[model samples]
Target chain A: MTHRVAVRPSGVELEVLDGEDVFTAAGRLGYRWPTVCGGKGTCRTCFVQVEEGAENCSPVGPLEREGIEALRRPVDGLTRLACRLRVEGPVTVTKRGVRRRVQE
Target chain B: MMDETSEPATARCPGPSVQDYLDQDSRPVPPALRYERNDYLGSEDIDTARFTSREWAEREMRQVWRRVWQFACLESEIPEVGDHEVYEIGDDSLIVVRTAPDEIRAYVNVCLHRGRKLRTGGGNVSEFRCSFHGFTWNLDGTMQTPPCAWDFPHVTPEKFALPEAQVATWRGFVFINMDPYAESFDSYRGTFDDYYIWPLENRYKSLHIAKVLPCNWKVAQDAFIESFHVIATHPQMLTWLADANSQYDVMADQPNWNRMINIQGAPSPHVADSVTEEDVLETFYDSRSFYSAAQGRDLVMQEGDELPAIPPGGTARQVLAARMREQLAATSQQDFSQTPDTELLDAINYLLFPNFNPWGGAKSNIIYRFRPNGLDPDSCTAEIIFMSSPKQPGETPPPAKIRWVPEDTLFADIPELGVLGPVFDQDCENLPYVQQGLKAMRKPGITLANYQESRIRHFNQTLDQWMSR
Candidate 1:
């Protein structure tokens, strides 16, 4: 079953499939997310604060944990790499610089 | 500011770091990694004319190329007395020959009698006999016969010897200097020997691919010297390469040489958020096949071969490096059990100034040489030498003949380059346009990433410094 990811501020909602990360779903849904490594957990720029449905997000894996630890600032329970987070249910996230492809 | 007894502290380099991956290596890493970093050159766009101006290229040929110790040929190429290879650089032709079992000498290819080139090709020769006038010189470059014994009364052995270039051998690689009074090769090389750990003497030139590129020599060279181009030029490598996190070192001690350590077998931060361990491993399978073919070594994997999956917590680097160690330990006579992942898996690229690139690694040790393609200024010849480990320890195999492909033929069309060819093609395609774009762009210069492209700036700075003299 596909879950809904609501990117805050931009209000861009994405239908994320099982085993798919949040960043891929955003691109698949015609949205551009801020990134240098582009979905690689290395840059950690595509990070989000979970505002709602925390339990629905996938558990942080080793890769995501390493990336979070490398962040300059301290992380709380809501902070997660958008590229590594997968949702099982409807979730809300805050991300800056998210945009939809302009339709011609 | 208050730590008086400790080493001087420098500013921290931000962003994803190669040191993080080095700390992740399961095996002991190279001690060379402990050195301090150099200051940034500057945040500036270098002049684009270096790639397009004919006058700039001419100045480089006279100023830079004339004075540097250029890598000519390997000692194994001329192990026997009288074995010779013709090395052609910008407007200069040299005959590198083994004068004795232990001595190698480089002579100006032109015969003293006339301007005709004495040797057309490399092969075993009793002497260099100019087919034009039959003015012959022995293997030692001493004048032997003048064809007509009584015709010339002014010829003497002392004045008649072939004009020689300064030649030096370091660990089996022969380097030649066109300037007779040029500084000794040891001094010109600087502290490169300190960090370079690979001993090339035990390797043989298994494959040599020389292609004439349609851009200035430095343009072709700048495409390399950094992994910054991987995101656009070699996207296939991103799944297993750490492009942004790779280390770049520019030091005052080794002004003539600069180095970079690109961590292979790991996902580039560019794709790190989305790529998984399986995806990284998958790409390696494809590249590993081609890398083996390029080296003419037995394929580490065959068609339908099952891959050992990356373990639950293990990295692609750890898994692949372990596999390489197993392959080397089995096939090679030397002990590879203790070789670190950095040596076996990292792309340790080093540039010996002007135009020679000798990589440091236990495997995938390739060499690149770039020179102006016959004074065109707009064209260059780039050669890649795949250095392979000998079948038996301490044994040297005959070097492969340099294969020159047509300028228009894509590197992908070359059977030996395999998948690496397309990556090269991407680099080649951009060069001509870059040469033309540099001429057409409204901007006077192009900006560079202060940290990533520091190598390019270091080289250009060095070139300008040399040219001003």
Candidate 2:
């Protein structure tokens, strides 16, 4: 029932139980992931690269879709919102550094 | 070439031609949404009376602020795991946290048990645990631990989840609203896309300066929108950037997204106007208006030498001239053209509706967020965050401390001015007194000036309209 989550650049990985949100599990493991809107998927701060097992995640919700639209990223195929993504089997997530010079 | 009256007999009629007359009459009446000049409340109304009373202040918060979106923090504040920052706005406190590698979450600062505040300031935390009873919730807001779980029967994690707030980020800035049914953040932004969408997204954070102000939030917010006050309220700012003939432009009016683009130059040397070329030249050379005289000394070159100014344009003179022209043009057109096609400086000031104001410039990106301090109406907390782009990722942050002299400190220098400085000192210093006056006043309300402070009037009018709705 354990699922794998991997972070990029830092390459930190953690395990979570099925049905656990990537945000919740990482937090329990003492790893920080950025989220505002409290994992409701309203703020795109919980965005991650679904390196593997994209099919294991849940479909994009309204809030995640809204965020993806704001980011001007395509939401049709692979990418999934981590807050909305339910752990199912093995999956890897990559964290990308913000491209802007000024961090919020 | 001829005598005044008699010359017209031989000369052209000098009257509008049929085509000219038709063109003049045919010109569409540019959107006749007349904003009432006197309908707004003034500083006198805000004096010691209204600002100090808790009940009056809470009513104002509900009528004016609760429905509007407020700037919470920057995405960079919680760039890594467990990084978090606390924001308080009008009796509400939200903790914005980086819960996962690419996740950020916000929750009400209160703990479910006994309603005590969970976290104080901000830091890295795997879980937010209530200090009162050792109840803990994971970053996602799910209950993880509770003392003596066996004692409480049928108590489930879902039953005691931490309350959450609506959060949205546009161009690196994060915003949150407590009202669940509030309109989407995009809708609230109105026409900000035309000016900020690109530059804000492209820009990086170089510096972060935060301060707390003591005045009612509106007063601090009002200090930013118009140049009318600069001449009197901010003498240093006036000496540095403003003039009598400075133009004003209302960028967007759907929800009072008004901004004044004041400049001291003409469009071109050939264009006819009262502002002299010398005045324009001086406007361009006056770097001391924005940067400190000490800072400008290094950038301003002698007569013919070349040097880079605080903003774009070649030398200090040309930079100032270009800035003036840009400001003047934008003011006249009611549009923003200050930002170039490709460069660092884009927006001068982004006055986000309600409570947030982001003043953008080449040297720094200063953001202001004003929130009510507590249940008390007369007092509000102003969080002034000063941000700058770092030369490199690991480069040192600017000096965290700012020096302020009590007598000599201008509104700009007081570290606590936004939080507790002379500016906040000036504003907050008067709020409590104003609140007391409101409670004691026997009459209905006060009046507002028509022209000098139109924005303030508009703000009150908007508040009335929203509250009525």
Candidate 3:
């Protein structure tokens, strides 16, 4: 089963395959997400806001919960570890810390 | 260099270097095994100007850096899929990533679209999306998407995969070769099959230090291949560093391997003064203290005000080994009972051609790597990785990021260096001075001691082979 994911601002529609996490689906579509620890759920650099259809995503795993809570800045409960969060239905995600044109 | 007034280069016990150590107390195969010298390398003169010449550095960059297998990063650094690290050599940058649970891949960090450097440092990425124009690539280097795909009619995903390099792993170190047709890792590291007998894959990097030094990479590397400088640069070590009695083995068959076995608990012959048993014990305590520091433990020595007498037949090496085993067992809570005494008591520094140095034995805990800084012949980055036996099986902690020390930052400022800080500080200080001295020298090149500096000579000879190619 496949679900649709809409990337905010860029207005790009992506097909998120069943069990495919939002972070990976976005990457599959060439929407680059910031990740320092890759998809290991260690670096937590891939945090993203599930602005719409939060219930459509899989429940947060332990690693994502710990990472989000440990974050220095307070984050909304809907913010999930993009690397660990798998999409279960259609959703919209707003990636934080991503800039279209930025210097490394 | 050993003084003319000192005794001959032979070890205290006779026979082949390996048999001599085995005869002592049934030790394992010594790091410095039976090895004959390559006469061709012995007579060749090394040009001192190579240290400061721009043309020579460029040639090395083209012929050596591009062609040789260089240490990219440790496998432990990127244990999970999508984990990557950027390794830059000369002007090229490579992104080493874990494509699967067990497989690692290397790709040129340049975006295939416009050739902009794709990544700078390291991080996890689902796919490599170039920040400039949003040209993205999957972890395996396949083009995932390109901005305005319909506008670029000529660009096809099949022909535009990110360029890749040859990657291989030895122990837990990930190595990359930029040359597409370079020789296999085994052929490149010929005699290294017997170089590390102990388990190297079991260890993980606990401390990662990278300091920019003002010297050619070779100059910085030469400072470490031999223990001759221990007397002058590390004066405190004169009491126990067997500088003159150390075994220097050169591999005639293998151009990429050499070893120096610096026996601990013995006095440097260059000191010319008789060392007391107390002095020897002090040196042992120093080593114990340092090892304890690495494990975040403080060792309290049992010695009193007066130095204890040496047990009738006991040598400093034996006494030190016994004490170290007990201390390590207590501090680390691990059974070292089966570990051999020789591995605990000796400083077995082994070098691979180009720039890979790993000290041998269970007690050995540090590895060093040197590389030219960008294109500058007068500057290089010296990386020191401190490793320890795993406290618990399969529980090795993740490695720390590379701590970059400034030009003036004291080694003591870095907690990870622990007790070895001063020794590293001494070497770091001497490299720049040596680089300056080379610049001032009028002679073709300085001479090397035949017996003690054999490894340095072998390294330079192997370097010339790669440079000539």
**For candidate 2 chain B, which ten residues in a row score worst on lDDT?**
B29-38
What is the descending TM-score order?
A: 3, 1, 2
lDDT of 3: 0.75
Which of candidates 1 and 3 reaches a greater lDDT? 1
Query: What order do candidates take by DockQ, descending?
Result: 3, 2, 1
lDDT of 3 at B95: 98
RMSD of 2: 16.1
Worst 10 residues of 3 chain B by lDDT: B10-19
RMSD of each: 29.5, 16.1, 7.6
lDDT of 3 by residue, A1-104 (tens): 88997777667677888888867777776666787545756556788777899888887654466568756534454788888887778888886544343346
Which run of 10 residues does model 1 chain B get worst, by summed lDDT? Answer: B1-10
User: How much does candidate 3 score in TM-score?
Assistant: 0.79
Best by DockQ: 3
Runs in model 1 lying further than 4 Å from the true structure: A1-104, B1-15, B149-151, B287-300
What are the TM-scores, per candidate, against the unseen true structure?
0.76, 0.58, 0.79
Clashes of 3: 5
DockQ scores of all models, one per candidate: 0.00, 0.02, 0.08
Could you tell me the lDDT of residue A50 within candidate 3?
79
